[model samples]
Target chain A: MSEMTGWLLVWPILLPVLASALAVVAWGRERTQTLIGFAGLLAQFVAALALFVQVWAQGPLAMSMGGWAAPFGIALAADTLGAGLTLIATLVALAIAVYAWADSTPEQRSGGLFPLVLALMTGVAGAFLTSDIFNLYVWFEVTLISSFGLIVLGGRREQIDGAVKYAVLNLLATTLLLIAIGLLYGLTGTLNMADLAAKVAQLPPGAALESIALLFLVSLGMKAALFPLYFWLPAAYHTPLPAVSALFAALLTKVGVYALIRVFTTVFPEGFALTREAMAWAAAATMLLGALGALAEVDLRRLVSYTVVSGVGVMVAGLAIGSEAALLAAIFYIVHSIIISAALFMAAGLVVRSAGSADIEQLSGLYKGVPWLAVAFLLAGLSLAGVPPLAGFWPKVYLVQAGLDAGAHMLVVAVLLSGFLLLLTVGRSFALVFWREAESAATPASPAPGASAALAGGGRHLRYALGALVLLTLLLGLYAAPVVEVALRAASELRAPGPYFDAVLGTAELRP
Target chain B: MEPLIAIVVGALFAISVFLLLSGSLIRLVMGLFVLSNATHLLIFVAGRLTRENPPLIAEGMKVAEAGIANPLPQALILTAIVISFSLFAFVLVLTYRAHRSLHTVDTEAMRVAEPAPRAARLRGRDV
Candidate 1:
C-alpha cells in the first residue's frame, strides 16, 4: 500500500543503473571499476533475494511513479514470475562480474567493457521488472543498446560484423514492438499492462487487435530467436568475448522467452489456444532446425549458438502447451539452460585461448592439459544433452509429460528427437576435444601474446563460477519439486487475470 | 489534420518497409529511423490528437474545461525517440565499422566464415 514499499520492486532495475553510472565514473581505473562491479553485483544479488522474500510474503507488489494510479500514471509490478527471473538474473550477473574480473586483461579493462557490461545488466533487469507495456519497450531498447556496446567492446572485425547485424535486426523487432504497443494503447487507451489486460477482453475481436498481437509475436519471437527469425543469433553471439557471449547466451534470448510467456499468458490468454498451436509447430521447426545446424557446425562458438536455437524449442514448447506443467517445464529449462550454456561458453573461451582457434578440428587433447575446464565443459555438455541427474533432465520430463497430457504427440516426439540430437552434438564436441589422439590433435604451440594470461590465471575463478553454476544445475534437477511448485503457482496466477487486475485497478467494478 | 497525419504516416511506413527490404545496410538504417518516427506519430494519434490544450493543468483550473492533451503518450514517444535515436547512431557507426572491416556492405558477402570442419586437428601433438 505504501509507495516506498512498492519501490522495492524497482531495486533490481535501479541497481544496474547505479552500477552503470559508477562504471562510467570509474572508467580508466581498472581496480576501481572491478570493485564497483563486484560491489554492485553483490548488492543487487542481495536485493533480489530480499525482494523475492517480499514477493513471497506479500502478493503482487505495484509501485506508481509520482503517486498516480494505473490508467493515469506509469506503474511497475512484480509478480512471482518476475521475482523469480530477477533472482536468476542477479545471480547470473554476479557470476559474470566475478568471471570478468578474473579473466579481463588490461586492454579489455581500458576498452570500457565494464561499463557496457553493467549497462547490459541494467537493461535486462529493467525489462524484467517494469509493468507498463510502453516502458517494457523502452527497457528492451536499453537492453539492445547495451548489448551492442558489449558485443563491440573488443572491436574485432568479426565482432563488428556480428554486432551490426544483431543491432539492425533487433532494431527492426523493436520497431514492430513499438507499433504493437501503439496499437494496443490506441485501442485500449491505457499503457499499463494490468489495465490493458482488463480492457482488451472487452474489445471485439477484430483486425487491429489481431494485428497488434501478431506484431508482438513477431517482434518478441525474433528476440527469443524462434526458428526463421534466428539467423542472426548464431553468428552474432559467436563473435563476442567469451564472458559477454556466455552472459548473452544465458540471459538475453531468455528475456525474449520471458516476455513472450508473460505477454501471452497475461494479456492474450483468450486467443492462446490457437496461438499455442502455432507456437508449438514453430517450436518443432526451431528445435529440429537448430539441432541440425548445431550438428553441422565445426566452430565451437557457432555450435553453441546453434544449440541456443535448439534450446529455444524447449522453452517454446513449454509456452505453447500452456499447461501448468508445461509452463513449469519452460521455467525450469530456462534457468538450467542459462547456467549450462554460460559455463560451456566460458569453457570454449578457455579452449580458444589455449589452442588459438575455436575451430573444433584445429584444437584437440584439451582434456589432458586443462582437466578442470574439460570436466566443467563435459558437465555442461551432458546437462545440455539432458542426461539424467543433470539440470536438463527434469525440464524435458515435465515438458514431455505436459505434451502427452495435452495430446500433442508430435511436439513430444520433436522434443525427444531434439534431445538426442543435442546429445550427438555434445558427444561429438567432447570426442573431438577430449578423446582424439594427441598427434591428430590441433594445438597451437603459442597463442598470441597475453592470451595465456587472460585464459590461464583465471582457472581458480572459472572453477568457482563453473562449480557454482554446475551445482545449481544439478541441485535443480535433483530437487525439481520446489522449482516446479513456484513455476506452477506463477503460471496459475498468470492464467487468472482477475486478481492482477483487481490489484492494479483498485478493485473497482468497471464495466465489462 | 488527422487525414494529413494519416497520409504522412502511411508514406513513412511504406518508405521504411521498402528500405528495410533493400540490401544496402545504410538504407536499412534509414528505414529503421523512418519506421520508428512513423510509430511515434501513430502513438500520438492513437492518444486522440489534441490540438488546443496542453497536458498540464494550471492552478485554479476546473475539471470541465481543462482539456489537456494526454501527457503519457508524449512521454512514451519522447522516450522512444531518444532510445531509437541513440540506437540509430550506434548502428550507423557499427555499419561503418563492419563495412570497413568486412570489405563489403553487401550482407551477402558477409557470409564467408563458415563453421570449422568437425574432423579438423589441433596444433600441439604432445599432451
Candidate 2:
C-alpha cells in the first residue's frame, strides 16, 4: 500500500478525536452537536470502510507517526481484522447516535452527549489500530474516561451507583494493563508490539515470561468480563440509558478481547498450553454461569447483560481452541454479537418505554401493542441464541467443527450446553415480556415515571435505528459467505504475524 | 539498590492491598493511588536503575553513546503516570459522588444494583 493508503488508517481515529473537540465547543447547541456528531460518525464509517477495503486489497497497512520507523515511533497498523472491527464499531456507533439523539432527554443532549460518544469512538478505533503497547494503554484510558462520563450522564442515582462500580473496577483493570505494558517494555526494551513479538520469541519460555502472560490475562480478562471477574458488568450495564448501554455492550469488552487476542497470538505464540487450558475452563464456566444467570433474571436489561457475558465466553472459547477455524469463528462471532446485542438492548429499551418497567414480571403483551418491535425482539433473541440461518448460527457451526477437530470434546459439549441454556433464557424472556397479559402476572414492578409518555412520544428515530440493526442481522444470516471469508483471512494474517510485522517495520525486516 | 527498591515496592503493594480490602471507601480510593505509585516504582526498578547520563544523542549521531540511561522505559513510565494520575482523580470524585448520593461509601452497602440472588432474597417468602 502506498503512503496515501496509510492515511486511511489515521482518518478513522483522527476524525473522531477532532469531532469530539468540535462537539464540546458546540456542546450547548444540542442541534449543532447532533449534526456535527452525526457527520463525524458518518465520515468515520466511510473511512473505516475504506480501510477495510484497502487492507483487503493490499494485505496490511501501517504508518509510523512523525516519519520515524517502528520500535521508535508509534506504529498505527491495520490488517483486515482491525479495519473490519473498526468498520463494524463505527456502524454501531452511528446507529447508537441516531437512537441516543431520540432517546436522550433534552437535558442529556445539553450535557455533552455528542462529544462523549465521539470520544468513545476515538478510543475504540485507536485501540484497534495501534501497534504500540503503551499507545494502546493511552487509547484504553481515553475509552475509559469517555465511557465513565457517558454511563453517568443522566445522573440518576442508579446511574451514579453503576458508574461508580464500573469506573472503579475498570480503572483498576486499565492500571494493571499499564503495569503490564511497563513490565513488558522492561523485559524487551521495546514498546512496539511487532518488535516485542520478535524479541520475546528469542527468550526461552520461563517463569518470568509465564508471570507476565498471567498478568496480561488477568488484566485483559477482567476488562473482557470473563467468568469470576464479571460481576461488575451485570451490576452497571443495566443502570445506563439504553443508548449508552448499547454502546458499552457493543464495544467495550470486545476491545479487551481484541487486546487479548492481539497480545497472546502476536507476541507469545510459543508454549501457551497452560494458559489456553485455563481459558478453556474459564470460558466454560463463564458461558454456563452467565446463561444461567440470564435465565434467572426477572429484569429484562439485566437478562440481556448476562447474555453479553455468555457471548464473550463463546468468543474466548474460540480463541482458546486456537485453530484457524476457531479463530475465524471467533472473529465472525464478535461481529455477530456486537450487532445482535446492540439490537437486543435497543429493543428492550423500547419495551421499557412502552411497558413503563424493565421487569418482565411487569411487562406483558408487547406483541399485541407493537408487533414490529416484538419481531425485532424475537429476531434478535433468536440470533443471540445461535439459531440456524441467523447471524449467530454460522459461527457456532464453525466453532463446533473446530472444537471437534482439536479434540476438545468437553469444550464442544460446553458450547452446546451454553447455547441450549441461552435458548431457554431468551424463550422465557420472550414469553414473559411479550406474550403474557399485564394483569396475569403475580406482581408488577412500579412503572418508572413517564414510561408510557416515552412510548407515545416522538421516537421515530429510535425505531429506525432498531430496524436498521435488525435488518443487518438478517442480511448477515442470509449472506454469511463473504463475512466468513473475511474472518478467515483476518485470522490467517493474525496467526502468521509476518505481514503484520513487515507492515509495521519494513519488508526487509522479514526473517524468512 | 535494585533489591531495596523492589522491597519497597512489595511493601507498598502489601499496604495498598490491605487498604483496598478495608470497608471504608475512602481507604479503598487511597489504596488505588498507593497501588498506582507502587506499580510505577516496580516498572522503574524493572528498567534497571543506573546513575548514568541521560539518554541523549547529538542530532547527527545514529544512537546514544554507551552508559546512557534507557530512555524508552522512562517514556513508558511517564505515559503510565499521567494516565493513572487522571484516572485516580476521576475515581476519587466518582466514589465521593456515589457516597453523597447513596449515603454510603461501603461497597457492601452499595446495593443499588444486583442485590442478593433471587432465591436467597425470597427465602420462601413468596407472596
Candidate 3:
C-alpha cells in the first residue's frame, strides 16, 4: 500500500476528533452545530468508504505513529473487517444524526449532544482502527466517557438513575479490561497486536495464557452485554433520547464484539479450549435471556434494547464456533444488527411520538393512525426476526450451517431457537401495538402534551432518514452476495494473520 | 519483592470487590477507586520490579542498554491512572447527582429507570 493509502486509515479517527472539537467550538448555536455534525459524519463516511475500498482492493493496511516501528511504537491497522465496520458505523452515525435533528428536544441539543456524539464516534473509529492493545484500552475509555455524557445528557431522574448503573458497571468492565491488558503485556513484554501474535504463538500452551484469555472473554463479554452482564444495557439504553439510543444500539456493543474477535483471532489464534467452551455457553445464555427479556418488556425502546442483546449473542456464537465461515456469518450479522437496531429504535421513537405513549398496552390503532410508520416498524421488525429475504436471515442461515459443519449442534439449536423467540417477541409487540384496537380509555404513559405536534414538525426529515436506513437494509438483503463475499474474505484474512502482520510490521516473513 | 506486592494487589482486589458488593453507592465509587489503584500497582509490579537507571539511550546509541529499567509498564500505569482518575471523578459526580435526584444511595432503592412491576412490588402488601 502507498503511504497516501496508509493515511486513509488515520482519517477515520482524525475526522471525528476534528469535527468534535469544531462542534464544541460551535456549541450553543444549534443550527451551526447541527451542520457540523452532519458534515463531520458525511466526511467520516467518505473516509470509511475510501478505507474500505482500499483494504478491499489491496489487502490489509497499517501505519505506525511518529515513525516508530511496530512492537515499539503504536500502530493503527485496518483489515477488511475493521474497515467495513468503520464504514457501517459512520453510515449509522450519519443516519442517527438526522434523526437527532428531528426527534431530539431542544434540551437534549443544548446538552452538548453534537459534540458528545462526535466524540463518541471518534472513540469508536479509534477503537476499530487501533492495533495496539493499550491504545485499544484508551479508545475504550474515550468511548466510555463520551457515552457517559450522552447517557446523562437530559438529566431526567431516569437518566440519572440509569447513568449510575451504566457508569459503575462499565467502569468495572473497563478496569477489568485494563487488568487483562496489563497481564498480557507482562506475559509477552509487547503491546502491539501484530508483535504479540508472534510472541504468544511462541509461548507454550499453559494455564497462564488460557487464564488471560478467560479474563479477556469475561471483560469483553461484559462490554458486549452478554446475558448476566447485560443488565446495564436495557436499564440505561431506554433512558436517552431516541437518536442517542439508536446510536448506542448500533455502535457501542459492536466495538466490544470487534475487540473480542480481534483479540481471539490475531493475538491468541490457537488453543484455549476452555475459554471457547465458556464463550459457547455465554453466547447461548445471552441469546435466550435477551429474547426472554424482550418478551417481558412493554416499553418499545427497552424491548428493542433486548433484541440488541440477542443480536450480540448471535455474533458471539459465531466467534465461539471458531471457523472462518462462522466468523463471516458473525460479521454479516454485525452489519445487519447495526442497521436494523437503529431502524427499530428510531421507528419506536416515532411510534411513541404518534401515539403519545411507549407502553404497548396503551398503544393501538397505529395501523390507521400512522400507516407509514407501521410499515417501517413492520419491515424493520421482520428483518430483525430473521425473516427470509431480509438482511438478518442470511447470517443466521450461514451461522447455522457453520455450526453444523463444526459439529456444534447445541449452538445451532440456540441460534435457531433465539430467532424463533425473537420472531414471537416482535410478532406479539406488533400485534399489541399496531394491530389490536385500544380496549380501555386509560393511558399509562400519556406522551408529554404536544409531543405529536413536535413530531409533526420534524416528521418528514425523520421519515426520510429512517426510510433510507430501511431501504439500505432491504438492498443489503437483496444484494447479499457481494457483501457476503467481502465478509468471507475478511474472515479468511483473520484466520491467516500473515498479511496483517506484513501490513502492520512491514515485514514479509513474519508468520505465526 | 514481586511476591509481596502481588499479595498486596490480591488483598486490595478482595477489599474492593467487597465494597463493590456493598449496596451503598458511595462505597461502590470508593471500591472503584481502590480497584483502579490496585490495577495500576499490578501493572507496576507486573513489569518485574527492578532497581536500575532510567531507560535513556546515550549519545549515538540506538537503544537503551540491557541493565536499564524497563519503562513501558510505568508508562502504561501512568496512562491507566490518568484515564481511571477522570472516570472516577465522573462516576463520583454521577453518584452524587443520582443521590440528590432519587433521594437514595442504595442501588436497590434507585429503581426509577427499571421500576419493579407494580404487581410484583404490591404483592402481599395491604393497599
Specify the highest-lDDT model's number.
Answer: 3
Using Cα atoms, each model's DockQ against the true complex is: 0.50, 0.57, 0.55
Per-residue lDDT of model 3, residues A269-305, tens digit only = 8749898888899999999989988988878889999
| lDDT score of residue A127 within candidate 1 | 79
Each model's number of backbone clashes? 10, 0, 0
lDDT of 1 at A255: 90
lDDT of 2 by residue, A225-287 (tens): 997899899999999889999999999999999998898888887537678888888888988
Candidate 1, A1-512: lDDT as tens digits: 65556667777778767987988897788778877777777877887788788877777776666657566666767778888888988897778767776667778876777777777777787778777788888888888888888888778888887887889888899889998888888788887788787788899988778878878888999999997899889879988888899889988999999899878877787654446667888899999899999988878999999998899988988888888888888988888888887878877877777666786765666666666667778888889989998879988999999999999898999999999999998888888776665443234543334344555676678668767887777788788788877777777777775665665555222111
RMSD of each: 3.8, 3.0, 3.5
lDDT of 3 at A55: 90
Q: Please provide TM-scores, in order, for all candidate models, with all chains considered together.
A: 0.93, 0.95, 0.96
Over 4 Å off, model 3: A443-454, A507-512, B57-66, B118-127
Candidate 3 lDDT tens digits, B4-115: 9999999999999999999999999999999999999999998877676767898998886766556899999989989998999899899889888999999889989997
Candidate 3 docking quality: incorrect, acceptable, medium or high: medium
lDDT of each: 0.80, 0.86, 0.88
Ranking by DockQ: 2, 3, 1
Best to worst by TM-score, what's the order? Answer: 3, 2, 1
